[model samples]
Target: MLLKRIQPMAYHARRLYVELMFQVMGRALQAVSEVDETVRREARALPAGLLFEMMVMPDGPRLVVEHTGDGHFLYHGSQAPRAVDLSIQFKHIAHAFLVLSFREKTAVAFANDRMLVDGEISQAVRMTRVLNRLESFILPKLVAQRAVKEYPKELRLPEKLLSAARIYLRIVTHLFQTARTS
Candidate 1:
Protein backbone atom coordinates (compact mmCIF):
# COMPACT_ATOMS: atom_id res chain seq x y z
CA MET A 1 0.00 0.00 0.00
CA LEU A 2 1.03 3.65 -0.36
CA LEU A 3 1.34 4.04 3.40
CA LYS A 4 3.69 1.10 3.73
CA ARG A 5 5.93 2.32 0.91
CA ILE A 6 6.06 5.81 2.35
CA GLN A 7 6.92 4.50 5.78
CA PRO A 8 9.96 2.59 4.56
CA MET A 9 11.15 5.56 2.52
CA ALA A 10 10.84 7.83 5.52
CA TYR A 11 12.83 5.45 7.67
CA HIS A 12 15.61 5.31 5.11
CA ALA A 13 15.70 9.07 4.82
CA ARG A 14 15.95 9.44 8.57
CA ARG A 15 18.68 6.84 8.65
CA LEU A 16 20.74 8.75 6.12
CA TYR A 17 20.27 12.02 7.94
CA VAL A 18 21.37 10.49 11.22
CA GLU A 19 24.41 9.01 9.54
CA LEU A 20 25.49 12.35 8.12
CA MET A 21 24.92 14.11 11.40
CA PHE A 22 27.01 11.54 13.23
CA GLN A 23 29.84 12.13 10.79
CA VAL A 24 29.64 15.87 11.27
CA MET A 25 29.50 15.54 15.04
CA GLY A 26 32.50 13.25 15.14
CA ARG A 27 34.54 15.62 13.00
CA ALA A 28 33.35 18.63 14.94
CA LEU A 29 34.45 17.08 18.21
CA GLN A 30 37.87 16.40 16.78
CA ALA A 31 38.07 19.88 15.26
CA VAL A 32 37.02 21.59 18.47
CA SER A 33 39.45 19.62 20.58
CA GLU A 34 42.32 20.94 18.52
CA VAL A 35 41.16 24.58 18.45
CA ASP A 36 39.18 25.24 21.62
CA GLU A 37 40.84 25.48 24.98
CA THR A 38 37.73 24.41 26.84
CA VAL A 39 37.31 21.32 24.71
CA ARG A 40 41.01 20.59 24.99
CA ARG A 41 40.77 20.75 28.76
CA GLU A 42 37.77 18.46 28.77
CA ALA A 43 39.49 16.01 26.45
CA ARG A 44 42.48 16.04 28.76
CA ALA A 45 40.21 15.21 31.64
CA LEU A 46 39.17 11.98 29.94
CA PRO A 47 41.43 8.99 30.31
CA ALA A 48 44.16 8.60 27.73
CA GLY A 49 43.31 6.23 24.88
CA LEU A 50 39.68 6.31 25.79
CA LEU A 51 37.33 5.17 23.06
CA PHE A 52 33.67 6.11 22.99
CA GLU A 53 30.89 5.57 20.48
CA MET A 54 27.43 6.93 19.71
CA MET A 55 25.15 4.83 17.57
CA VAL A 56 21.58 3.99 16.72
CA MET A 57 20.54 0.51 17.78
CA PRO A 58 20.17 -2.49 15.45
CA ASP A 59 22.41 -1.68 12.49
CA GLY A 60 22.19 2.11 12.35
CA PRO A 61 25.04 4.50 11.64
CA ARG A 62 27.58 5.20 14.37
CA LEU A 63 30.71 7.21 15.08
CA VAL A 64 33.62 6.45 17.33
CA VAL A 65 35.91 8.89 19.12
CA GLU A 66 39.25 8.22 20.74
CA HIS A 67 41.12 10.51 23.08
CA THR A 68 44.82 10.81 22.47
CA GLY A 69 47.14 11.18 25.39
CA ASP A 70 47.89 14.83 24.67
CA GLY A 71 44.46 16.45 24.90
CA HIS A 72 43.08 15.78 21.45
CA PHE A 73 40.39 13.58 19.93
CA LEU A 74 40.37 11.46 16.78
CA TYR A 75 37.32 10.51 14.79
CA HIS A 76 37.24 6.78 14.01
CA GLY A 77 34.35 6.79 11.58
CA SER A 78 31.53 4.26 12.03
CA GLN A 79 33.57 1.17 12.67
CA ALA A 80 33.72 0.77 16.44
CA PRO A 81 36.97 -0.29 17.97
CA ARG A 82 37.45 -3.73 19.51
CA ALA A 83 36.80 -2.36 22.97
CA VAL A 84 34.91 0.88 23.48
CA ASP A 85 35.19 2.57 26.85
CA LEU A 86 31.70 4.01 26.44
CA SER A 87 28.81 3.36 24.14
CA ILE A 88 25.79 5.65 23.89
CA GLN A 89 23.13 3.85 21.90
CA PHE A 90 19.90 5.38 20.73
CA LYS A 91 16.92 3.11 21.01
CA HIS A 92 15.83 3.88 17.47
CA ILE A 93 16.73 5.83 14.37
CA ALA A 94 13.83 8.15 15.13
CA HIS A 95 15.35 9.00 18.47
CA ALA A 96 18.72 9.66 16.89
CA PHE A 97 17.08 11.80 14.21
CA LEU A 98 15.26 13.85 16.79
CA VAL A 99 18.40 14.58 18.75
CA LEU A 100 20.65 15.07 15.70
CA SER A 101 18.18 17.45 14.05
CA PHE A 102 18.02 19.44 17.29
CA ARG A 103 14.32 18.76 17.83
CA GLU A 104 15.23 17.19 21.19
CA LYS A 105 18.03 18.12 23.51
CA THR A 106 20.29 15.20 24.50
CA ALA A 107 19.47 15.45 28.18
CA VAL A 108 15.77 15.46 27.42
CA ALA A 109 16.17 12.49 25.11
CA PHE A 110 18.05 10.57 27.79
CA ALA A 111 15.44 11.49 30.37
CA ASN A 112 12.74 10.24 28.05
CA ASP A 113 14.55 6.92 27.66
CA ARG A 114 15.55 7.42 24.05
CA MET A 115 19.15 6.44 24.72
CA LEU A 116 21.10 3.88 26.71
CA VAL A 117 24.51 4.57 28.13
CA ASP A 118 26.98 1.72 28.65
CA GLY A 119 29.78 3.28 30.57
CA GLU A 120 30.88 4.92 33.77
CA ILE A 121 28.70 7.75 35.01
CA SER A 122 31.61 10.12 35.56
CA GLN A 123 32.96 9.52 32.06
CA ALA A 124 29.55 10.12 30.57
CA VAL A 125 29.29 13.39 32.46
CA ARG A 126 32.63 14.57 31.15
CA MET A 127 31.71 13.64 27.60
CA THR A 128 28.39 15.44 27.94
CA ARG A 129 30.19 18.61 28.94
CA VAL A 130 32.46 18.31 25.93
CA LEU A 131 29.49 17.75 23.64
CA ASN A 132 27.61 20.75 25.06
CA ARG A 133 30.64 22.97 24.58
CA LEU A 134 31.03 21.80 20.98
CA GLU A 135 27.35 22.46 20.28
CA SER A 136 27.70 25.98 21.65
CA PHE A 137 30.64 26.64 19.35
CA ILE A 138 29.26 25.14 16.12
CA LEU A 139 25.56 25.98 16.30
CA PRO A 140 23.94 29.41 16.05
CA LYS A 141 22.80 31.03 19.25
CA LEU A 142 19.10 30.35 18.81
CA VAL A 143 19.55 26.72 17.78
CA ALA A 144 22.35 26.12 20.26
CA GLN A 145 20.25 27.48 23.09
CA ARG A 146 17.55 24.97 22.26
CA ALA A 147 19.94 22.11 21.73
CA VAL A 148 21.97 22.43 24.90
CA LYS A 149 20.69 22.66 28.47
CA GLU A 150 22.47 25.99 29.00
CA TYR A 151 24.26 28.06 26.41
CA PRO A 152 27.46 29.57 27.70
CA LYS A 153 27.24 33.29 28.49
CA GLU A 154 30.90 33.73 27.64
CA LEU A 155 30.36 32.77 23.99
CA ARG A 156 29.80 36.07 22.20
CA LEU A 157 28.25 36.21 18.74
CA PRO A 158 31.46 37.11 16.99
CA GLU A 159 33.37 34.34 18.70
CA LYS A 160 30.64 31.87 17.94
CA LEU A 161 30.62 32.73 14.25
CA LEU A 162 34.38 32.49 14.00
CA SER A 163 34.53 29.17 15.78
CA ALA A 164 31.70 27.78 13.71
CA ALA A 165 33.47 28.81 10.54
CA ARG A 166 36.68 27.18 11.65
CA ILE A 167 34.95 23.96 12.66
CA TYR A 168 33.01 23.80 9.38
CA LEU A 169 36.17 24.28 7.37
CA ARG A 170 37.81 21.42 9.17
CA ILE A 171 34.82 19.21 8.59
CA VAL A 172 34.73 19.95 4.89
CA THR A 173 38.44 19.45 4.50
CA HIS A 174 38.31 16.18 6.33
CA LEU A 175 35.42 14.99 4.22
CA PHE A 176 37.23 15.79 1.01
CA GLN A 177 40.34 14.05 2.21
CA THR A 178 38.35 11.00 3.17
CA ALA A 179 36.54 10.94 -0.14
CA ARG A 180 39.77 11.07 -2.06
CA THR A 181 41.24 8.21 -0.09
CA SER A 182 38.08 6.20 -0.45
Candidate 2:
Protein backbone atom coordinates (compact mmCIF):
# COMPACT_ATOMS: atom_id res chain seq x y z
CA MET A 1 0.00 0.00 0.00
CA LEU A 2 2.81 2.45 0.83
CA LEU A 3 4.75 1.71 -2.37
CA LYS A 4 1.60 2.09 -4.47
CA ARG A 5 0.82 5.46 -2.92
CA ILE A 6 4.38 6.71 -3.52
CA GLN A 7 4.24 5.63 -7.16
CA PRO A 8 1.12 7.71 -7.84
CA MET A 9 2.69 10.78 -6.25
CA ALA A 10 5.82 10.36 -8.39
CA TYR A 11 3.72 10.00 -11.52
CA HIS A 12 1.75 13.13 -10.73
CA ALA A 13 4.94 15.06 -10.14
CA ARG A 14 6.25 14.01 -13.56
CA ARG A 15 3.04 15.11 -15.23
CA LEU A 16 3.21 18.48 -13.53
CA TYR A 17 6.77 18.92 -14.72
CA VAL A 18 5.68 18.23 -18.29
CA GLU A 19 2.84 20.72 -18.08
CA LEU A 20 5.09 23.45 -16.72
CA MET A 21 7.60 22.73 -19.48
CA PHE A 22 4.94 23.11 -22.14
CA GLN A 23 3.91 26.44 -20.68
CA VAL A 24 7.46 27.77 -20.90
CA MET A 25 7.79 26.26 -24.37
CA GLY A 26 4.67 28.04 -25.57
CA ARG A 27 6.15 31.42 -24.67
CA ALA A 28 9.51 30.60 -26.22
CA LEU A 29 7.86 29.30 -29.39
CA GLN A 30 5.94 32.53 -29.77
CA ALA A 31 9.16 34.49 -29.45
CA VAL A 32 10.98 32.36 -32.02
CA SER A 33 8.13 32.42 -34.52
CA GLU A 34 8.13 36.20 -34.41
CA VAL A 35 11.84 36.21 -35.10
CA ASP A 36 11.22 33.88 -38.07
CA GLU A 37 8.68 36.28 -39.47
CA THR A 38 11.14 39.15 -39.09
CA VAL A 39 13.83 37.14 -40.85
CA ARG A 40 11.46 36.49 -43.72
CA ARG A 41 10.62 40.18 -43.94
CA GLU A 42 14.31 41.11 -43.92
CA ALA A 43 15.12 38.46 -46.49
CA ARG A 44 12.87 40.25 -48.92
CA ALA A 45 14.96 43.42 -48.55
CA LEU A 46 18.44 41.88 -48.76
CA PRO A 47 20.63 41.97 -51.89
CA ALA A 48 21.59 38.86 -53.85
CA GLY A 49 24.41 36.39 -53.06
CA LEU A 50 24.03 36.89 -49.30
CA LEU A 51 23.46 33.23 -48.50
CA PHE A 52 22.73 32.85 -44.79
CA GLU A 53 22.04 29.93 -42.43
CA MET A 54 21.12 30.59 -38.80
CA MET A 55 21.38 27.73 -36.30
CA VAL A 56 20.16 28.73 -32.87
CA MET A 57 20.20 26.43 -29.87
CA PRO A 58 17.88 27.85 -27.23
CA ASP A 59 17.46 26.59 -23.65
CA GLY A 60 14.77 24.08 -24.51
CA PRO A 61 15.14 23.56 -28.26
CA ARG A 62 17.37 24.14 -31.26
CA LEU A 63 16.14 26.21 -34.19
CA VAL A 64 17.69 26.03 -37.66
CA VAL A 65 16.77 28.78 -40.10
CA GLU A 66 18.22 28.75 -43.58
CA HIS A 67 17.61 31.41 -46.17
CA THR A 68 18.26 29.67 -49.46
CA GLY A 69 18.29 31.48 -52.76
CA ASP A 70 16.27 34.58 -53.58
CA GLY A 71 14.40 35.24 -50.30
CA HIS A 72 13.54 31.63 -49.54
CA PHE A 73 13.46 30.68 -45.82
CA LEU A 74 13.22 27.33 -44.02
CA TYR A 75 13.04 26.68 -40.26
CA HIS A 76 12.41 24.02 -37.62
CA GLY A 77 12.25 23.75 -33.82
CA SER A 78 13.64 20.64 -32.12
CA GLN A 79 15.95 19.38 -29.40
CA ALA A 80 18.31 17.98 -32.01
CA PRO A 81 18.91 20.58 -34.67
CA ARG A 82 19.78 19.52 -38.21
CA ALA A 83 23.46 19.48 -39.12
CA VAL A 84 24.51 22.78 -40.68
CA ASP A 85 27.64 24.82 -41.39
CA LEU A 86 27.29 26.62 -38.08
CA SER A 87 25.54 26.25 -34.69
CA ILE A 88 25.18 28.72 -31.83
CA GLN A 89 24.26 27.49 -28.37
CA PHE A 90 22.66 29.58 -25.63
CA LYS A 91 22.75 28.37 -22.03
CA HIS A 92 19.63 30.19 -20.92
CA ILE A 93 16.82 32.41 -22.17
CA ALA A 94 18.92 35.39 -21.12
CA HIS A 95 21.75 34.17 -23.32
CA ALA A 96 19.53 33.62 -26.35
CA PHE A 97 19.70 36.00 -29.28
CA LEU A 98 16.20 37.43 -29.27
CA VAL A 99 15.02 38.24 -32.78
CA LEU A 100 11.86 40.13 -33.56
CA SER A 101 10.14 39.35 -30.25
CA PHE A 102 11.21 35.69 -30.38
CA ARG A 103 14.45 33.83 -29.86
CA GLU A 104 16.42 32.69 -32.89
CA LYS A 105 18.22 30.13 -30.72
CA THR A 106 18.72 28.93 -27.18
CA ALA A 107 21.18 26.59 -25.42
CA VAL A 108 21.23 24.09 -22.60
CA ALA A 109 22.50 25.34 -19.24
CA PHE A 110 25.94 23.73 -19.27
CA ALA A 111 26.88 24.54 -22.89
CA ASN A 112 27.87 28.11 -22.01
CA ASP A 113 30.62 26.83 -19.71
CA ARG A 114 31.54 24.16 -22.26
CA MET A 115 31.76 26.76 -25.04
CA LEU A 116 31.43 24.31 -27.91
CA VAL A 117 31.58 25.59 -31.51
CA ASP A 118 31.27 23.02 -34.27
CA GLY A 119 32.23 24.47 -37.63
CA GLU A 120 35.09 25.45 -39.92
CA ILE A 121 37.03 28.67 -39.35
CA SER A 122 35.29 30.33 -42.27
CA GLN A 123 31.95 29.33 -40.87
CA ALA A 124 33.03 30.76 -37.51
CA VAL A 125 33.74 34.10 -39.18
CA ARG A 126 30.35 34.04 -40.85
CA MET A 127 28.77 33.17 -37.53
CA THR A 128 30.55 36.15 -35.99
CA ARG A 129 29.22 38.43 -38.70
CA VAL A 130 25.69 37.19 -38.17
CA LEU A 131 25.98 37.56 -34.41
CA ASN A 132 27.49 41.00 -34.79
CA ARG A 133 24.44 42.05 -36.75
CA LEU A 134 22.14 40.58 -34.15
CA GLU A 135 24.15 42.10 -31.33
CA SER A 136 23.82 45.55 -32.82
CA PHE A 137 20.09 45.06 -33.06
CA ILE A 138 19.40 43.63 -29.59
CA LEU A 139 22.40 44.34 -27.40
CA PRO A 140 21.14 47.74 -26.34
CA LYS A 141 18.16 46.14 -24.64
CA LEU A 142 20.39 43.74 -22.78
CA VAL A 143 22.74 46.52 -21.77
CA ALA A 144 19.88 48.63 -20.54
CA GLN A 145 18.58 45.81 -18.38
CA ARG A 146 22.02 45.26 -16.89
CA ALA A 147 22.67 48.94 -16.49
CA VAL A 148 20.16 49.00 -13.63
CA LYS A 149 22.02 46.29 -11.79
CA GLU A 150 25.02 46.90 -9.56
CA TYR A 151 28.05 45.50 -11.31
CA PRO A 152 31.48 45.65 -9.79
CA LYS A 153 33.95 48.03 -11.41
CA GLU A 154 36.31 45.12 -11.97
CA LEU A 155 33.76 43.30 -14.10
CA ARG A 156 33.72 46.18 -16.62
CA LEU A 157 37.48 46.33 -17.14
CA PRO A 158 37.40 44.09 -20.19
CA GLU A 159 35.10 46.50 -22.02
CA LYS A 160 37.36 49.41 -21.08
CA LEU A 161 40.37 47.47 -22.37
CA LEU A 162 38.66 46.88 -25.73
CA SER A 163 37.75 50.58 -25.98
CA ALA A 164 41.37 51.50 -25.31
CA ALA A 165 42.54 49.13 -28.04
CA ARG A 166 40.15 50.71 -30.54
CA ILE A 167 41.46 54.18 -29.67
CA TYR A 168 45.06 52.97 -30.12
CA LEU A 169 44.20 51.48 -33.54
CA ARG A 170 42.65 54.78 -34.67
CA ILE A 171 45.77 56.70 -33.66
CA VAL A 172 48.02 54.20 -35.42
CA THR A 173 45.92 54.43 -38.58
CA HIS A 174 46.21 58.24 -38.56
CA LEU A 175 50.01 58.02 -38.13
CA PHE A 176 50.34 55.48 -40.95
CA GLN A 177 48.25 57.62 -43.32
CA THR A 178 50.39 60.66 -42.55
CA ALA A 179 53.60 58.68 -43.11
CA ARG A 180 52.38 57.29 -46.45
CA THR A 181 51.05 60.61 -47.84
CA SER A 182 54.15 62.60 -46.75
Q: In terms of lDDT, which candidate is strongest?
A: 1
Tens-digit lDDT track for model 2 on 76-156? 323224445555443333333232123332222223352345655454444343333233333344552332222223324
Residue 173 alpha-carbon offset, candidate 2, angstroms:
45
Q: What's the C-alpha lDDT at position 50 in model 1?
A: 93
Question: RMSD of model 2, in Å?
Answer: 17.5
lDDT of each: 0.90, 0.39
Off by over 4 Å in 2: 1-60, 70-73, 79-82, 90-113, 139-182
Which residue pairs overlap in candidate 2's backbone? 31-102, 57-106, 57-107, 58-106, 58-107, 59-107, 90-107
lDDT of 1 by residue, 94-160 (tens): 9999999999999999999999999987888789889999999988789988899899999998888
Q: Estimate each model's TM-score.
A: 0.95, 0.32
Scored by Cα lDDT, where does model 1 land?
A: 0.90
